[model samples]
Target: MALECINLEHVPASHTIHAALFQNIKNASFLHQQLLAGNTEFEYALIDASVIISRLHALAAIYRAVNDLLGNKLRSRNVHSEIVFSLSPNNNIAESFRRFGISPETTSLLVIKVSTPSSPAAGEDIQSHLSKVVDGEQVDFSDGVLRAMTDMVRVKKIYKLNYSSGVNGRGKENAVYGSDRTSQDSKELEMLILGSMALRGATN
Candidate 1:
């Protein structure tokens, strides 16, 4: 498998590689519903950078395409929207996640994409649970604008891939690589992708 890089910020607004990913999160109610559902993995509400919406959009297609390609190796879970790349006796989960990184491994990693707006407000309908968590930096892209935000994501259970850092934050914190701390292992990454794809305008 080829290594992949996610320009999360460029994702939703990207007409270049992933136009389908961010087609409708802006001012869309259905899209908002989709975002809400995507965030449910966290027992408490955790906000993703705005760019996650775009990543969600692009991965929707990738998930569908890859599932067909791997067939058995990859399974898409609808309830949680995660691409379960089964690491057989020959493979490991960490290696799979590494394949997506500059220097990756054969073990699979869960890529759970989320949707956060350009701005967030209270009472948006989210959870407030925090246990076994870590803080990190988040670099996000939106409509071509590059910026970073201080991120707090859940990290237990996912592996060494925990504690993702920010790339575009205006503050002092630098970016790190790991899982999103919005919730816990109760939800899978693929489920979030499915919900976020719904944030895009519906397909014919």
Candidate 2:
């Protein structure tokens, strides 16, 4: 897997992000434990790939988290944890962690870290660190890879999606661009989730 360097819109140069996707992870518990223990070396955002629908899904959360970090409105301990929180439709921090954070059963994983002047030059060494600690094969971060990893049933349950009827928990009110749900695909589903997440932060 390669470290994807992203220069987000309006975000400062120092906030550039380096992210990677992995699969067949074997030490998820240990990785999760490291995060739980607040290990500085494991500052990367370790996400359960099964819950991520696409690269955009992951990016949207990252964008929100970084935005919050820049604004000093972060609801979690840091930008990494905020990414997991941004993925949730609702704003329950702990539940978001439980659902999206890495676990012993998590086979596919996504790792993200940010570059800043004050922080260690972790982005440059991300691939090496991940290779040493994560027992998994690195893969290109793409929608095809994420799509295969996504759990449709659990995704629907988490987002309260009912695509069979093209409505969600908020019904037509939550649909974006007035698009109906009858012909939804991965693209439409992604849009719906993004819309909901946007509204969530706005309301908060």
Candidate 3:
């Protein structure tokens, strides 16, 4: 199956994370409508794959959301929405949805489902439902796949990492400097993103 079951560290065993990546999605508008209409079956974190950097980036957001859910401090409606919200550097819930969540223009998608004790969804059930509802090609959810799908320009813009005097000052196309340079830059960007997310939580 394309669905990957993840066991996050420091999270309760009762909360399991299931994730999938879809490329060339054909029914983005339909999926977006389902979220807008509050379809219970569509309670998944439908993230725009372009904004995602790697599996770690996505998992970090999932961990934060689930942790909040466990503490009963969720700022959004549920753990699913909280996952998307956790990606933003600010506390603007609606803007977070618009920037990170799925839209009609989204061609690639990162779908995440968190199974909690209150709503225990089996991995098989999630895989089956996703196969039927999401019209796209399911690909392995891995760092390589995610890196290929990432839109660095958009990601830098959203995270405000485009400054000309910081870690990203080397410019977005640092790949020309060699694979090692590219890898180093990506790691720095990931740290900056995580720091921003943590700072937002601290302020709140």
Candidate 4:
């Protein structure tokens, strides 16, 4: 009832992301790196205990990527970017966007045209608009990273794959960008934000 299923074919705008992004594994590759992060099986294979700590390595890699994105760009006065982490309903893109910063135009709703209608996490249309426009098989920054153009906010997502005993990823905001979003951290983060801005401007 929450508008789970959709048809992307109906949403023409998404087609613009075609080829440039959807054609490669790079866009979504970030997911593969972090999804299976906390399993101790890697360490148990002789020293599986190392698997737990290794999880951070992957996470750090992601942070590094984010750093890269941010370091070179994202320093303008108009750019408002925020990162969110999702843990429930399996931390899929749907849940990831649920916690994302909301803009007036795109409240709690997300439209997707997933082939599997039975998929429990196929995203929901917040307002339940009867004639909601559903877009199919399009480029979405939903699950792992969402980068939006200037208007208001630039949002990214973190899948909380680990917790106390595992990679729960609590307080990710502080962990990633720090509480103030302006605190001094490694030069890596500064460069990452700047890099994001440069990339965004290049696209324009």
Candidate 5:
């Protein structure tokens, strides 16, 4: 029952999102297979949590995907898959899926289901559906949970960031919050990476 229904800013009311974080998943491979098989019941965006740095890092990707969906500009199969694609800095859809999508070994997971006017399912309905299929303990979708799930080494590698001291792009280092070095730098890196991924769908 750890599912959260989030009302996004600027998104239409008909597009409420249901997001959940799962830990110590026992059926990751099964779930991954379901997605690969194109099971209609497994339409939720299943993300590998290790590549995520914070809730906003995940939210930024969701925002960009949903925004594109609203504009009829989806670059992938659907909004759910596009959420994973939006996390990548490049436009390679399959690579994005391979990197961010669930795998056989993924233990920590992020599940996102968008309820649009075309497919309006209540939060309770989505929660019930996930609870039955996903074999993991649901937890709050907060920064603390997400931070523990993040793999710093993998995140830097995925984004091709040079150093761990700080993120280098769009003057983000200068824009970093004045706080503890480790945590503050991580936040900056997440922000910088989010900005980088967001720029992929930018329009003139």
Candidate 6:
């Protein structure tokens, strides 16, 4: 199936992470509405893929949120919402949802489902549900796929890595990997984003 079952290290064995990517989403508004209505079946972390940098970037956020879940330190409604909230450099839950979470206009979408002992979801079940609900092309969740969908400008701005860093605000110059310098710059930006995510509440 297109849904990948990820085995994250340092987490409980009962917690299994299932993720999927979708392109050319046609019913983002409907999905957004399900979230707004608090549909229990639609409890996945529905993120806007444009702001994502890579698979690692997304995994870092998931790791943080899952850790929080295990520690009983979740600040959001659940692990799914916490995953979205963990992407922000700041502790604004609502704003994080607006910037990182899915919207009506989101074309490329990232869906994360953490199956816990309490609410266990099989990989097949997740894949089937997503296939029916999300009207989009299911693609492999890979770094290469994510790179094509990333909006570096939005990512940098959200992480506050714009003017302070020497890299240009527009993603074009920094994203070009034809040159070694640009490739290194892109990697540096990913590191910066991870750092920002890691230090989210500590700074404030």
- Give each model's whole-structure lDDT: 0.27, 0.81, 0.86, 0.24, 0.85, 0.88
TM-score of each: 0.24, 0.87, 0.91, 0.17, 0.89, 0.93
Report the error of model 4 at residue 130, Å: 7.3
lDDT of 1: 0.27
Per-residue lDDT for 58 in model 5?
89
Clashes per model (N, Cα, C within 3 A):
37, 0, 0, 33, 0, 0
In model 6, state the lDDT of residue 157. 74
Q: Report the C-alpha lDDT of model 1 over 1-204, residue by residue, as the tens digit.
A: 111234333344321121111111222333234334655443111122222223343354444433433343333332123222221111343432222211111111122232324222122221111111212222223322212221123121222234233332222233332235422321343344344333332431
Task: State which candidate has the highest lDDT.
Answer: 6
Off by over 4 Å in 4: 1-110, 117-148, 151-204
Model 5 C-alpha lDDT per residue in residues 1-204, reported as the tens digit of each score: 567988889988889888999999999999999999999988899999988878888888899899999999999999999999999988889999999999999999999999888888888888888999999999888877776677767778888877665433322343443448856667677778877786764631
- lDDT, candidate 4, equals 0.24
Worst lDDT window (10 residues) for model 5?
166-175
Model 6 per-residue lDDT tens digits across residues 55-172: 8899999999999999999999999999999999998999999999999999999999999999999999999999899999999898777777877777777887762332453333
TM-score of 3: 0.91
Instruction: Give the local distance difference test score of model 6.
Output: 0.88
Rank the models by lDDT, top first.
6, 3, 5, 2, 1, 4
Using lDDT as the yardstick, the better of models 3 and 6 is: 6
Q: Which TM-score value belongs to model 2?
A: 0.87
Best TM-score among the predictions, by candidate number: 6
For candidate 4, the TM-score is: 0.17
lDDT of 6 at 27: 98
